[model samples]
Target: MKILIVEDEPELLKVMSVFLEREQYVVERATDYASGLSKIANYTYDCILLDVMLPGGSGISLLRALRDMGKLDSVIVVSAKDAVEDKVQGLELGADDYLAKPFHLSELLARIKTVIRRNNQHREQALEFKNVKLFPEDRKLLVNELEVCLNRKEYDLFYYFMIRPGKLVPKTALAEAVWGDSADQADSLDFIYSQIKNLRKKLKDSHAEIDFQAVYGIGYKLM
Candidate 1:
């Protein structure tokens, strides 16, 4: 998962980045309001950790701007101002959660997980697609009460397909999501095809009827 942190305090920002990265999340940081807003405008994050006091402007203004632009679902206000009204105002503006300045990194991580859980409508800790059950948190895939062992890319490919069931997914899209940012630099998408082939064979061997349909001109659809 990807997260954006908007904080001005260098030490706190660094600590948070390290903590979140340790938890296996992609972390991006912005020191002030302008940079934060620019990042929000450009990238999609699972959640945002926004500091109220910024170098260029107030976090409340940033929250307001996010709301104005329909990004209310992606922000959580983190600030030193712990007034009752400040909390209330931030909540009313659609911040998913609020954490005071002095907080445990664990607590912040938990909040991010909670926000992501709340946003995911069709997924639980155990992701269910048709008859297949994928425990993303546990990296386990089960079909018809049977456990199926999968390699990292195989698991990721399965999870991605479950996340967007019934929709055709392109080979490049799968590569970019499952692989690192360097997926764009790959010489061929043959590796993706190979992964798909292995994943499908495993599912079929398990008696799972999940279909990875090739769309000919487009991509594969998880049916």
Candidate 2:
């Protein structure tokens, strides 16, 4: 899972990042509202940890902005303000969950899990595409009930493909989605081709009833 932590408190931010990383989450940090907003604009996250107070702007305003952008289901409010009014406002403004200060980290983790479980459209931890199953939490792929070990890039390729089943994904789009800004200077498309090749091999080996096709003058399509 990917989580964005938008807390200005240095100590608390570090602690939260350490704990969540240990739990196998890809944790990203943003110390202030603008930084957090940039992250929200650029990347897709499974969840966001937002603070009410920040150096430049209030978390409430940030949440409101995200809500306007139709991102309410992806945010959790974490604040030191424990007032009833604050909690009500956050919930009303579209926070999935609220965690007050001085709470246990374990409690926060559990709350994250609960919010994700409630918000998940798939109804489970595993996402299904035809005959393949991709488990986001475990980072595992299974076909016909048999596990298929995959390399890092191969796993990422299949994950994106499954999420966009039957869709044509351009090589540049996939490169940018996976490598972010670094893909701007990518000299060759060989790396992406190699990963796709490996992913196709693994799926076929596992007896997956899916086909990865190269579209002429385009990119790839999972069918």
Candidate 3:
């Protein structure tokens, strides 16, 4: 999963980034309100860790802006402010959870997982599309109850497609969703084609009922 950490304290920011990265999350950081706003406006994330007191503005304002833009990304307000009003304001403005400073990294991880689960209430432990089933917790895929092994990238790509079955997914969006911010550095989308090819072969070999159809020069749609 990918997360955005909006914090001004350099040490805390670095510590959170390292801890979350070690836990296998793709971590992105912003030092202040402006940078955080820019990142949220341009990209999507599974979760956002927001610090209330920021250089340019309050994290409350950023949360308000996010809601104004109709972005429902799960937000956890991580701040030193433990005041009741602060917490109330954050919750009222759409933050999914709040964590005060001096908390354990393990606790933060637990809260992150909880908020993400709440945000994705529509998706259960196992995601099903046609005859294929994806166990996200185990990173396992099965067709007709038979396991179909896939590498990390292949699984990520296939899962991305599975969630949006029958919908056309643009190449750039797919790359960003699976590869995170690093996808911006790619010169072309040839890598997506290669990944799709491998996933297609795997699905076909497994006799899966669904398939991905290329959209000529645009993208692909899972059908």
Highest-lDDT candidate: 3
TM, every model: 0.78, 0.81, 0.92
Against the true structure, whose TM-score is highest?
A: 3
Between candidates 1 and 3, the lDDT winner: 3
What are the runs in model 3 whose C-alpha is more than 4 Å off?
none
Candidate 2 lDDT, tens digit per residue, 1-223? 5688999989999999999877866687899888877777766667889888888998888888887777644788887755667678889998898888888999989999888778877656788888888897678988987889986667766777887789999887777556553464788877888888888787778788998999976799999
Tens digits of lDDT, candidate 1, 1-223 = 6678889999998999998877766677889889878877655567889888899898888889888887645678887755667678889999988888699888888898888778766556787777899986777989997899997678877777898889988877776666644465798888888988998899889989787999875679898
Error of 2 at 14 (Å): 1.9
Candidates' lDDT values, in order?
0.80, 0.80, 0.88
Q: Candidate 3, residues 1-223: lDDT per residue as tens digits?
A: 7799999999999999999877767789899999999989988888999999999999999999999999999999877745677789999999999998889999999999899878975569988988999987678999999999998788878877777789999998888877787687799989999999999899999999989999998899999
* Structure candidate 2, residue pairs in collision: none
After superposition, the stretches of candidate 2 with alpha carbons farther than 4 Å from their true spots are: 151-157, 170-191, 215-219
Off by over 4 Å in 1: 123-125, 150-157, 170-198, 201-205, 214-219
User: Which residue pairs in model 1 clash with each other?
Assistant: none
